[model samples]
Structure formats: structure tokens, C-alpha cells
Target: MRYSKFLLPTSKEAPSDADSTSMKYMYRAGMIRKVSAGLFYYLPYFNMILRKVNFRIRRGMEKLNSNEMKFPILVSQEILESSNRWNAFNKEMFKLKDRNDNGYAISPTNEEYATLVSNLFVKSYNDLPFSIYQIQQKHRDEIRPRNGVVRAREFTMKDAYSFHADEKDLHDYYKLMGEEYTKIFADLGIKTFPVLADSGAMGGNMCHEYMAISPEGEAEIGFCDACGYAANLEKVECKDIYSIDGTYKNKYDKIETPDAKTIAELMNMLQMEAKQFVKSMVYNADGNLVMVLVRGDRNVNEVKLANFLKATNLELATEKEIKSIGSVMGFVGPIGDLQNVRIIGDFEIKGMKNFVVGANEKNMHLRDVDACDIKCEWADMRFADENDVCPKCGAPLHVSQGNELGHIFALGKRYTEVMDSVFVGNDGKNHVPFMGCYGIGLERTVASIIDQHHDEKGLVLPMSVAPFKVDIIIVDTKKENQVKTAEELYNALEDAGVPVLLDDRSERAGVKFNDFELIGVPIRVTCGRSIENGKLEIVRRDNGETVEVEIANAKDFIINMIKNY
Candidate 1:
């Protein structure tokens, strides 16, 4: 490719709207242009990255015997209603009406469509374990899509689905897809770890997300340092080390606490540590008053709380709701024989003894309270933090934040059963097929690759994904010898089956050098005064290593250097 003719619009200044390091560098490298909030124009260089990523994903799927196919982005609402997901996914789903006034949706995913496809083609158990995939655009109506391509409204996805006649087959395929996802990430040169994921209302390792660790990411993960147990923040569990089985010095007793409504105030007044107090929080779980208790030092992770209680909505209880429960706001406790309203306790609560709790009144507390004396169900309902003991091996966990690049899930019979799509079994009866889903966000994956592989200058793309393998720079385009040598080298590299970019523009040497680095071609060759000496200067982009090679051996050396790319 000739740099002068190509649409490589390199810029000196980064865009103000970029929300991450990758986003800024991507703009400066001319891989993308911002069209609107949450929308972008992926330039030719960006398309090159997408093509490579898509090729790798397709290769992975084919190895697992999955057939590639395409689905319409705009889906009829009838399909969603058939799958019983219309109402459930109404919010965050983009709805529309066509000319005939029929409701439709810009598909966020292809779950229902895949089921519909099976409804037509899969007629017998002989077609069991069917796997199909597609690389296309997906949409979401984001209230606020931040983090550049990391949270875009319309982006590319490589989504795959599998149908099995039995649970074992589905489970097996799920594992296979997980392995394939790991391989895909490896091939892409991105580091990833799979963590436990929520597979809807059902739970288990049947669902997992391949997360790319990055400091600029948005998701949090907790991992065991000893047993390799890792999980997302919403589902991670720490050992119950704070629960007290021994008795306390004093039994439950009323104590005066003036203006000590908060935990910090009470801790200061009683000269006690945060672990000595039970932090009781009031919440409205699906419009019903409920109390969630955790240690004062811990926080209630609402995602876990709602999932545990099977609540559709979980938010802090209004003052009116708290008052109606015969409890003071900020003073509600699991004790005091409080009735009607349900109380839920964290796993840590079981180990707490002789702890302080609210007395169901203002400016008062119940001291020396044992959780056993309180009526509540205990479960893991708090965020696992740093230094928390690992539930698997009792080692301190290492918790960090990251970005998810891929996810594979076992859908069980959720869609197949709901849509009443079934196949004739060997038993001569119609039975629903178990389903599994796998997805990779192409835009996010590209951005994460940039995040994982860039430096202060610009993108340091992996050799396999770099737009071109070699860059030929005419240090002085005004010099005829430099131009002829650069063109000859470019033609020679092309003849050797290597992609090379020739900087044929009449620009300054410094400008050409900066642009080549920003674009990040893996190898660069300068045909300057070196050509007069029967030599060529080769530069490795990753390490800036320079070597002088005889002009006759330049093509073979460059080919060998980028052969593994």
C-alpha cells in the first residue's frame, strides 16, 4: 500500500471525547473517527483489524464443527413473544414498528432467532448437537454508553449457538466452546481469564466470561491466589472468617447512642472496630420491605442480593416503608422480634457474636447481640474485597478490575422450551433441545487489543494483526535513489508474499517516521544513504532494534523475521 494514496489520516492531537487510552490512540492512529456519541466510523485500518479478528474467530468455530451463517438484525416481535422474552427484555431493547404496524426489534442478540431457525429446520433428534454462528452487528438502547467502543450502541459480534438433545451433550459442547474461546484469545495475543458468570436464574460454571485484565476497564473480578478460583464481583464468595461461634462478654442489652445513627459514629462512641458492629441495611426487594445485614466494614453488593432473593427490583427502602415496618430509619435491626418484613443476613453474620446492632429506635443500639438470637437466612451477599480469604483454599484473594472480551453460556432449555420448539426423539416423543450461547464483542475486543498492546506513542499491534508487516520509508523522497530503492524493496516484499506499506509521500523524514510508528507496522526499512552503501536499515517497531543488511538479502531477512507473524 502507498501511504500517500491511502486514507491514513494520522493526527497529532487526540480527541477530547475519547474515554480511554486506546480510544485516544486509536483516533490519533486514524483507525476510527467519532461520528456521534457511542457511534464511530471504523476506517480502513480498523477494518483490517476486524478482518483478522473475524478470520481467527471463524477458524476457531470451524474447528468445533460449527457452521457459519447470518441472521437479520431487525427481528419480528412475534419471535420474541413466542420465546416469552418480549416483556422481560422490553427495557434496554430497541423496539420499532414497520409500515404494517408490526412491532420489531433491532436485535440485541439472536437467542430467539436461533430458536426460530431450529423450529423450521431441526425436525428430528438426528439433527442433535447442531451448532451455528454469525459475525454481524448487534444493537442496544444504551441510556449512557461510555468508554468509547467498550460500550457502544451498535457494534459487531461473533455469536454462536448450539442445540443438543440432552443435558450432557449441552454441557460437553459448552466446555468445548469455552476451550475454543480461550484459544481464540490466545491467537489474538490477548491475556484472558474465565470467571464464573450468571447464566440467568440458574447458576453454575455452565456460564463464564473471558475477561481481559486492564487498569482502564470497568468490570471487577476476584481470584483465589492458591486454588485458581476466580469469579465476577457479583458472584464471587469469600470465606466466612468474621462469623463468631464463641460467646460474647455480655448478652443483648439496650444502650444509649445519641446521634450515633451511622456505623462510623457508633464505632467512635463505643471505641469499637467496624467488625464489632452489624451493619443492617433496609431495602425494598420487589416493593416488599427487607433487611440485609453485613459486617460494618463490608458493603452490600445489590446484584448478589437481588439474585439471591429472586427479586425483580432491589433498591434502598423508602423512609415511609421503613416506618411502616415499625422500625426507625437507619436503626432497623434483625433482632427486637421485628415481624412481617423478611430479614436476610450475609454469611459473615453467622460468625459475629457480642456485636452491636440497631434497637429499632432512634439514638439507641442493642449491645452484645448474637446473630443466632436473630431470625434471618444467611447467604453470601456481599462484595469480596482485597485481603478476603478465598472460599476455595482459604488464601487471601487478589481482586482486580477488567474488561470482558468473550462469554459462553449454557442456556439449558430456556429458549427452546419457551418457544415450544422441539424435535422428535428416539423415544418417539417431542422433546425440547438444550441450548448454549457464545459471544465475542468485536469492537471491544479490538479496543482491548489496543489497550493490551499500546504504548505512550501509539498502537503496538501484534505482528499477526498489524495492518502491514513491513513499512518502506523514503527518508528523502526528493532523492531519486531513495524513491527507486524504496519502491524496489516494496515490490520485493510484495513478491515475497509479505504486506508492506511504502511511504512515498513528499513529507519530511521526521513526519514520515512519526506516522510509521503511530500506525505500528511491525517492521520498517529505510532506503536513505544506506542504499548508496549497498545496505538497508531495518527497524523493529516493538523494540526499535536497527540492523544493517546487504540490499540483496533484505527481502529474505524481512520475510523470515515476519514469518511467524
Candidate 2:
């Protein structure tokens, strides 16, 4: 590739809307252009890198005995409905109507389509235990798609699904896929931690997510440095509540709290730790007013709460709804004039000796209330934070943010039973096949790579995914000797099976070098006046190290440097 013929738009000014390092560098390097809030256009330069990444992934997948296949981007709604994902997926799924008023959707995922394909072709157990993967576009209506490609409504994904006749086969394939994922990330030069994760709508028991640690990440993971136990915060478990030593005698009473609404206000007014106060909230779960109680210091993990209630729909009750229920916004509690609402309390609250709770009346609260007197169902309904002790090892949990690049789910019989994907055994008995899904967000992975490998200058692409392996720069393009020598060296590098970019533009040496660094071409060959003296300079983009080499040996030197990178 020649800079004179290519669109290498490099800018020193960062976009005002760029919030992350990857977004800023990608924009400055002209690798991607934002079309909408969560939509982007990948330029040719970035597309080249994407192609190389896809090649690596496909090569590894082939070695794992996985077949590459492409599925339709637009799928009929009937298939999704049959799999019970149409409603389960809800608004996050992009749906549309075709000319015949038939419902369709831009595939958010191809689990249903893959299952349908398997049902059409696969019959007996002999056809089982095969995996197919595809690199294709996926659409999800993210409520808040911020941080550029890290969370996007439209993006590329590498999704693979494996079918097996039995649980043993599924487990074996899952382990193999895990190993392959480790290798994939290793090949991309990223060290990732596979943490247990909640499958969410994917409907699986055992799931793991490949997380790349980054402060800009949205997902919160709870990690115990002492025990090395890590899990997504939504799934993190805490120890059982400490037993209370004594019983309380104070009767439930309402007192004026006076304009104290938030937990902080209540804590400040009462001058007590949040652990000593009860946080009561009203939730509308499937049109039922459910009173949820947690320690004031702890936040609610809505996923855990929803799963506990076994409710399909749950949301915080609106202020208006709360007012209609005969309770003020700030002073709501479980005890009040009798109502049909279900009251649920956190397990920790049950062990609390004497605590303060909302009075369910305006500007009032009940202090030193006994849990034995309070009547409610105890549940693990709150999020575990840094202060919480790990249920497994008793180590304090440390919270860190991470980006989910890949997720593997051990989906056992959920979809297969619903879709009637069955197999016959040697004993002639019909059995549902076990299923597993593994997914990698292709664009997010690229964004995460940039997030991890960039500096103030620009993107510092890992050598494995760089668009070009080497960039050849003529320090003085106006000098015919330098230009000729650079061109010859570039050709030689290309002949040596290295992807080389020739900076033949009329730009100054500083501009060319800056562009090369911004784009993160791993190796650079500088042909200047020194080249006329039978010497050339090789610069590494990652570290600003320049090595002088004889002009005759420049090709081998560049190739060797790239090999090491």
C-alpha cells in the first residue's frame, strides 16, 4: 500500500465527543467514522485489520474441527417465536415487517437460526457433536450505546454453536472451546480472565465470559485477590448473614424524619452507618407491588432480584405509583395499613438486631425496629459490593470494571426441549440434545485491543492485528535517491511476505512518521540521506527505538523485527 494513493487521514485534534482512548485514536487515525450514536463505518484501513483478525480466528477454529458457515442477517420471526426468544428478547431485538406483513428481525443472535439449520440437516446421533461458526453482522437495540464500539447497536460478531447428543459430549466440546478461546486471545496479544457469568436471556446454567480489564468497561466484576475467585457482580455470592445475638423489644413506631429522602440523607440525619438502616423500595413485578428491603449501604442487583422472584417482568415502581399506594416517596416500608403487596427482605436484614426503617407515611420513620417482629420473606436480593465477603472463601471482594469480549454458555436442553431437537440413542429412546453457545463481539474485541494497547500518540496495534506489518518511509521524498531506495526496500519487504506500507506522499518526514505511529504499523524502514551512504534506519512503532542497518540488509532486518513483534 502506498500513502500517496491511500486515504490516510491523520488528525492531531481529538473529537470532542470521543470519551475513550480507543475512540479518540480510531477517529484521529481515520480508521472509523461514527454514523450515529451506536453505529460506525469502518474504513479500508481498519477493515484490513479486521480481515486479519478474522483470518486468525478462522484458522484457529479450523484447527479445532469447527466448520465456518454464514447465516442470514434477517431471520423470520416465526423461528424466534418457536424458540421462545421473541418475547424473551423483548425490545433489545430489532424487529420489522416485510411486504406481506410477516414479522422479521435483524438477527441479534443466530441461536434460533442455527438450531433450525441443525434440525433440517441433522437427524441421528451420528450427525451430532459438530460445531459451526460465522463472522457476521448483529443488531441489538442497546438502551445506552456509549464508549464507541465497546457497546454498539450494530456490530460484527463471531458466534459459534455446538450440538451434542448428550451432556458428556457437550461438556467435552465446551472445554475444547474454552481452550480455543484462550489461544485466540493469546494470539491477539491480550491476556484475558475467564470469569463465571450469568447467561441472562441466553438461558444457560454454566457460562463464562472472557473479560479484558479496563476502567472504561461497563460490566462490574467481583474479584477476590486472595482466593482468586472472580465472577460478574450480578452472579457474585456472599456468605450467609451473621446470626443476631439478642432480640429487640421496641415496638414499631413512626417518627418524623423531615425531608430526609435519600439513603445519605437518612444516614446523615441519624448519624449512623448505612448497615444499621433498612432501605425499602417498591417494585412493580408483573403488576404486583412488591416491597423490597436491603441494607442501606448495599445496592440492589436487579438481575438477582428478578431471578429470585421468578418474575418475567420487573421494574421500579414509579413515584406516582408509590404515591397512589398510600406511601410517601421517601418513607415507604412493608408495615402499613393492610395491602395485597408482597413484602420481601434481604437475608442480612433478617439477622439485623435493631434497625431503622421507613414508616410508610410522609416524613416519618421507625427506628430501632426488631427484625423478629417484622414479617417478611428473606431472600438474597441485593448486590454484593467490596465490603461483602465471598461466599466461597470468606475473602473480601474487590470490584473492578471489565469489558466482555466473549461469552460461552453451557445451554443444557433449554432450547432443544422447546424446539423438539431430539436424537435417538442405541436403545431407541428419544432424548433432547444438549447445546452450547460461544460468542465473540468482533468490533468490541477490536475496541478493547485498542483500549489496552494505545498511548497518547495514537493506537498501538498489536503486531498480529496491525493493518500493515511494516511501513517504509522516505525521510526526504524530494530526494530522488531516498525515494528510489525506499521503493526498492518496500518491494523487497513485500516479496519477503511482509505487508508493507510505502510512504511515497509529498508530506514531510515528521508528518509521515506521526501517521505511521498513529496507525501503529509495527515496523518502519526510514530511507534518508543515510541510505545514500549505504545505511537505513528501522524504527519500531511500539517503542521509539531506531536501528541502523546496511541498505543491502534492510529487508532481512525489517522482516526479522516484524517476526519478533
Q: Return the TM-score for each candidate structure.
A: 0.90, 0.96
Which window of ten consecutive residues has the lowest lDDT sum in model 2?
Answer: 241-250
Steric overlap count per candidate: 3, 0
lDDT of each: 0.85, 0.83
lDDT of 1: 0.85
lDDT string, candidate 2, 302-395, tens digits: 7887788776677889987787777878888766673766888888877786688888787899987877766788778887887888767887
Clashing pairs in 2: none
Runs in model 2 deviating more than 4 A are: 248-252, 268-273, 320-326
Model 1: how far residue 29 lies from native, Å? 1.8
Model 1 TM-score (2 dp): 0.90
